[model samples]
Target: MDNNILILSEGMQTSIQDLGRKGYRAYGVPIAGAMDKYSAILANKLLNNDEKLPVMEMTYTGPKILFEDATLLVITGADMSPKINDKPIKMNVLYEVKTSDVLSFGKLKSGARTYLGVKGGFLTEKKLDSYSFYEGITSQSRVNKGDRLRIENYEAGMELYSSKIKVKRSHFEAKKLEVTKGPEFHRLTKKHREYLFSKQFKIGSLNDRMGCQLKNKFPPIKDQEIITSSTIPGTVQLTPSGKLIIMMRDCPTTGGYPRILQLTDMAINQLAQKKENDMFKFDLESSFDFLGRLVFRFKD
Candidate 1:
């Protein structure tokens, strides 16, 4: 595994991410992981790697990489029009890249983030028992140009595996996100509650790994704040300024804003693929309803 990839250009925001460091939220640490868990898992699975192995989480733009050795790579999530040695290649399929092969991306066609998984996963220093990068935790928050990432067993015999496997792209297109009542869901006035469900929200341009700031056309809430309490990814808090913030995988472990709605695990995954300016509605469901849908989706 002495082979390494030299980063020629760091895209908008590229970072090594895994399933995130869990069980550290009590210490006010955020779970900084891949924004799109489904895509990360798919990329890893295609390489027969661990389901939670670290992958490159490329946002908006993708990095330019020069492989020092021939290795298998799988691209999932957003279609960034990847190319090997300047030859256009399709995504969601494993392809062998020869030594000195240059990999890069073109304009984004769909989705916001893309997952790049190497043959044996990208080797990086871990913090809090996880490889996911965080600003204050990991030594490096994001990959930069000229950085070298060691690839495990890059020169070893390539394992024989499926030549190409296609994952349905339609699963990433979601317009409605399912949510459940949060702790303060009942505290809102009747009109406010109705407005929350009936109105549409647009993903603000300021959205990032911390959370997705939503723009609402309605009036601002009357400065109703709550005592700082525990929060986690998917916690929907309504700011006094009338904006809605859907916490993401990198959001802080707690907050003081009023928690109005909480997105389900599936909803969070679906929302992660949405880019700025995308519009989506929140559909509230009961606990039983949520579990029922979850079961049916994964029954196989």
Candidate 2:
């Protein structure tokens, strides 16, 4: 008997994602994956599954799923107020579902995306050596209503499990984003450079998996156009029109805009949890400077 989950109602945006695809960017393929990799990893770890297991990434809302077999699973990242058979469940803890059990959600309490991971992970098709779903690179990009997600079956008579490890409350807060100097950081005029650090940027409605569009407040950089060059997730680019775009997991491999800054991995994780109109300040620091602070903080 095969174990599967039937999607009754796909919420705002639901897609399967993992860590990301690597070593294929030179071929024009973006490393599409979970926007909040930290939470995704947490969900998998709670269930004792592989760290790279593909999990469902639900944004703003969550999907309604009906299980076809007994299974162990966990929800992390956003708190969408998930429920099983009309019983409210908490996040960061494992839960067991019986056959024909219905899982649904209520209002989104925090964060931008929620991650759901079944024990042993979902069985999805892989492309270019990854299970991450990218529009043009995967068999399908988003989960739709009525989609069936195959899952690994648990052993018969296996004991159900739960956890008490609550994901840190700080995961949902977006205040200061740590950044390092980019290749073009030094090219900016003194005033513009100072403005970048002093200004607070609001996440615009144009934000998507490809990149985060931030509403700019200061003057535009002069002669910001640049030659096309390699780009990666966390790269902050400034366009000619004074718009600021921070590349995300699904961003293209290269861009022509002036790369102004690069976010630290922790900052990228924090930024991914932000929603439209969310405000955040930029905290500029170099890698070496950050290392010095870390060493000082932990000195014997």
Candidate 3:
């Protein structure tokens, strides 16, 4: 019999994701992948699987799955309260599941996203060299109930029983996001710069994988329009109306708004676990001064 996981209930937003599709952004493809890359990678690492292996990215809630074969698995990110046969399981640890064992999740104790990694990864379609499920780029955007996901049937070795990993609690609790000056940072006036760093910004209602809109508006720049330029995950754009949008994994390839700040890779992962109404402050460090100079030279 082929190994498979039968989906009993599709939770809020469960989908297959890896590290995201790269090199296709120039062609206008949004890199849709696991929002919390650190947790996703950690889950894979704990399972002794490739870090880039496709795993289930569960948002807010989690899906109920029935295992068809014995396999090693691990859960990380967000305390979604995972369980097997109604018995609780710990996060960041590897365990074996037997045939007919059902895994489910309860109340979200903390964080906003969760990751489930299985040995050998999932046998899913790989488009553009990625298993990331994007709206138009992939056959289906999210997993639905009644879906049977293929997996590898395997018996765990002794190495699986001795694996142990510790996750940092700060990743989900930190409120200070580290960012570097972006291409248009030089355009901001002294007052605007002060406002950017001084105030706390709330995650707006329009938050998702595409981007995060901040509720607090910064003072709008006199010249709000800018020539359309390349954008990537973590590019913080300030709009004419003064609203700030932090582009995420599924943002467009280019944007016209002024890119005033860019979050560090770690900051992007940090922001990914934040939900609407979450408060955070910018921590503009000087470590990226050299990169800021390079951006200013070309953008100016």
For model 2 the TM-score comes to 0.94
Tens digits of per-residue lDDT for model 2, 1-300: 678999999997799999999989879999888899999898888888888999999999898999988888889998999999989998888788889999999999998899999989989889888899998888788899999989998874474665658667776896899888899987788988788888889999988889999987457766677889999999999887788899999999999998989987778889989999999999988768889867987999
Model 1 clashing residue pairs (backbone): 1-153
- Put down candidate 3 lDDT per residue, 1-300, tens digits, no spaces: 778999999998899999999989878999888999999999888888889999999999999999988789899999999999999999998888888999999999888999999999998889999999999998999999999999966875644675777778889988899998999999999998898888899999998888999999787678888999999999999988889999999899999999999998789899988888999999897866658756876994
Per-residue CA lDDT of model 1 for 6-124, tens digit only, reads: 99999988999999999898888898888889899989988899988899999989999999888889999999999998899888887888889999999999888999999889888
Task: Summing lDDT over every window of 10 consecutive residues in candidate 1, give the lowest-scoring window.
Answer: 154-163
TM-score of each: 0.93, 0.94, 0.94
Best by lDDT: 3
Best of the two (2, 3) by lDDT: 3
Clashes of 1: 1
Distance (Å) between predicted and true CA of 268, model 2? 1.3
Ranking 1 against 3 by TM-score, winner: 3
Clashes (candidate 2): 0
Go through the candidates in order and give the clash count of each.
1, 0, 0
**Model 1 scores what on Cα lDDT?**
0.87
After superposition, which runs of candidate 3 have C-alpha atoms over 4 Å from their true positions?
156-159, 288-300
